[model samples]
Target chain A: MGKMELVDSDGAKLSSALNRIARDIDAVFDVLLPVPDDTRAPLVEAMRYSAMDGGKRVRPLLVVATAEMLGVSRDPALRVGCAVEAIHVYSLIHDDLPCMDDDELRRGKATLHKAYDEATAVLAGDSLHALAFEILTDDETTPDPFTQAELVRTLAAASGMAGMAGGQMMDMAAESADYDLHTITRLQQLKTGALLAASVEMGAILAKIPREGRSHLRAYARDIGLAFQIADDLLDAEGDEEKAGKALRKDDEQGKQTFVTLMGVEGARNQARALVDHAVGHLGQYGEDAAVLRALARYIVERDR
Target chain B: MGKMELVDSDGAKLSSALNRIARDIDAVFDVLLPVPDDTRAPLVEAMRYSAMDGGKRVRPLLVVATAEMLGVSRDPALRVGCAVEAIHVYSLIHDDLPCMDDDELRRGKATLHKAYDEATAVLAGDSLHALAFEILTDDETTPDPFTQAELVRTLAAASGMAGMAGGQMMDMAAESADYDLHTITRLQQLKTGALLAASVEMGAILAKIPREGRSHLRAYARDIGLAFQIADDLLDAEGDEEKAGKALRKDDEQGKQTFVTLMGVEGARNQARALVDHAVGHLGQYGEDAAVLRALARYIVERDR
Candidate 1:
């Protein structure tokens, strides 16, 4: 049902579609720039730092790969995919700002606000956040504006209070209090799972998938989102700083609760494996076409950093 | 071709459709949730604080008045108006946060972060922002889904960097450096004017006004947005805190330039008057039906606050 060679096996995998998607995403940022070109330099620079910095373009990969696997052209989905990545980058920029996480380094580079003033960093984050939806809603290539609008609403809801913001609040409150495994899982679901779910949901939306397939895709994303977060926690507990691009176990120093904190290190690892297995099983419903998605889930758990 | 009664001698008073439209806007906010429901309590309270905080609901008013003046039923426009107001309130809450403006008082009451904790405040602002578009894009609405989609694109652009955020960035930068009158005017246009223009533009859109008329409406809004900002600056210079709600003349202390700073009090006042006249002139093309919109512009300039 599929060609395996098209899927890269190397740890540093770079699919052609993924690379094109990244470039397309960068191009979207170039649109709608402010005048007096210098005024927008800081904004453009900070967004570049946050977005173009070294990290796998996983969210965008998910968007394009899913669309391709569904036997559709990737162009329309690519724009939406890039928009998703923009939102992800915006989140990371804000999360690392002085008022939020206050981290100095991201992907082994100085964080956006650390490189610039706090206010500029904040505006850059806000701008990127807004740009994400603007790109999705205003994409001329998308055939169905109504579907695009639904995608905007879906991403907004998942990325906003009921999801990411709620998780952030929980994370902040839990800093001073003890939280159990379930509480930690719920927070992770909101913070990470919400966007990931939206990624798949958006792909389905752009593909015009029927309701039943959409539900399964959503479930697949939900499982992967949690699995991905668990893998991240495990990596933070056991991975190396040079390899991971940031220090490991900083969450402990911050008194932040994660899957590793709520459960033992071994327990967290086991949970991640279980989730990956579960997510991959759901792909069975889609047959061989979901091969890349299955591999992606496995990579989340197995990757050293 | 005209009715003097439609224009209040004291101000540009609203006709019945416009007044009913405002009530209708409030009713949407007053969703019939059962008393003391735990899930909605926080959201409802936050919505009340954010929505009812009061700034004349100018954007919504523009939308409703524009729709009515174009001979559309006020009902559909009412929902959109409320949605725009929700977005406006959300932006204000975030703008007042410690991370942003760090304002303590708004409309003579403690800002959301001061009233609640910073985390709740941030989440509340985020929720309201998401809720705004959610209301507009809801499937239950009678407006065609495609039109709703277009509205999302328009509102998102107005609220995002190329519009509101662009204005905000300029405003923030203006505090630190020297700026000319053109710079100040540009900032005001992007920050306040973009949304104001969008308000009228969206109304024209909802009414399905002819493209030329819509463009004229936008031109009217552009002029009025600057005029409105000049009036605001004038008010800040001379108005009382009891009426203005915010501390009067803070812009001067902050070293922020305004039309008043660029044009002096009298010059800025004259510019505002001219803008009002121009706005009314545009309404003339629409005749007596647009009397409420004409009056609203005058009121925007002449209001004590």
Candidate 2:
């Protein structure tokens, strides 16, 4: 509750937790990718490069921290976390393709299509998508087949229609047509929030937490998910490209509607802060066990990139 | 079997069964596609056009027929069949992309990317891929979650790095390099046979048949898979495009080593005939329950297109 405690937990501890998860997930991907690669060298390399390339491991950390709080085993949690990252990265790769957003930079490096060919980029994304399901259904993901099926169903629903892909279609349409705040909010919910909400809920799914028990966590995730996008829009409007590791000012250049454009920078920032406060409040039941997630909700809105 | 029975079964009966399955799967695709016609019209339309436009739906028929013979309930079997068809159609849509085979025609119609734009085709394929896994893991796919999980695992393994995608990488590389019979055969096995084998195996899985009991069926699928590719090569060499629907003589034009190129036309035909016989012989244990499959193997080799 005190200012000093907030500074210590929110700043140093959050960064430390993020770093630890980054290392663990990178190791998971490293060991999991087949060695002695034959014909799949380019595809495998593209997958590894896109997935393991140093983006912030926010989703994985959410999976790990929430699962730990719920007393779930670290093994299945880590594998599930990696699967989420694979899907996330695959989405990024496809979103960056020439026929899509066509951005040349990602993670401070050339996008997959820019670095590799379009065909390899497509295959890498496609292969990673399959691998995510493969990992979730593997015996190593969970000994219980029922739990594995649940994860597969959860992720497939999160990433498919009425979810990420559907959100992307809405987004593509947004560039050509006029959209108000509600439509943009719905678009953001589908495009960005679906996976983020799913990521938080995965911790509960791994622990087999009851629906009622996890509702507050879902509330927390939904709040921060919107907050995350507002932060993204703020970054695009005013942040530095070197820090963000991708292009900035794209929304403005493309004449796309964003939180900043809709609400003004100051208003958008205030709203994001309000969302983070509500998100942190939803963790009241978890007490000290949710300290990391509490700090993350705050850190998410406050991060520079 | 009696000679008169073979004559009755081979000609009208096989075609009739194929027609029946083709219609059933088309109906399955029809009801499955969401039709509110909201923001996802383009994506939903693309998915419908590609999945329902037209194909043999051989994979779906394989799933339905084999499961029916195994006494598996029709509901789950039909859903699994649709899932397999979805995966197969997704592969076809992606394969016809400008970056891949760049084909203009499929099933006597313009390929998806040709009919629609490239990005829509990519999303359609990607969405269908996820839909396959989604359908497999859904509660509607089966009452037992374990069986559903097994289907997810099987389909993912058949389509990912060590399977179809890996095979595609090899196939792309083949254009730039010289490959022998063994390499091409391995490519064909992974590219085509893995999915076919998985399709046959799904029936056994749905029936809860043990691995040992399904081994002969797996063997049968493997043999016919190779025979199917050989027959394809012969079609590419000598068949009419109007009948085949897609472009012909592609293997020769691309200078790819195929069964017909490695073995003479007569030699390839003989090998395919032998494989069909072996495949049918493996089903001896199933008796008349597997009559459709036996006729299918022979028909695969005998059909001109």
**What is candidate 2's CA lDDT for residue A77?**
92
RMSD (Cα, Å) for all candidates, in order, is 3.4, 1.5
TM-scores for all predictions? 0.90, 0.97
Please state the i-RMS of candidate 2: 0.8
Model 1 / residue B24 / CA error / Å: 4.7
* lDDT per residue as tens, model 2, B1-305: 69678756655667887898888888888988975456778998999998885887778878887899999877788899999888888888988998889999999999998888888888888889989988998788797988998898889998987888888888888877677888888988988888988999998899998888888999999999999989998999999999999999998889988888888999999999999989989998988788788888888887766
lDDT score, candidate 1 = 0.74
Cα error, residue A74 of model 1, in Å, equals: 2.7
Best by lDDT: 2
Complex DockQ per candidate: 0.46, 0.81
Local accuracy of candidate 1 as per-residue lDDT tens digits, A1-305: 13345335522243454466667665654553433463545666667667763567778778877887787677777777767887787677767765566688887888887788766766676677777767777757475777777787788888766677657666766777577777788888888999888888887877778767687788789899998998898888888788787657878888877888778888988988898878877777777677667777777777766
TM-score result, candidate 2 = 0.97
Of candidate 2 chain A, the 10-residue stretch with the lowest lDDT total is A31-40
Clashing pairs in 1: B12-B295
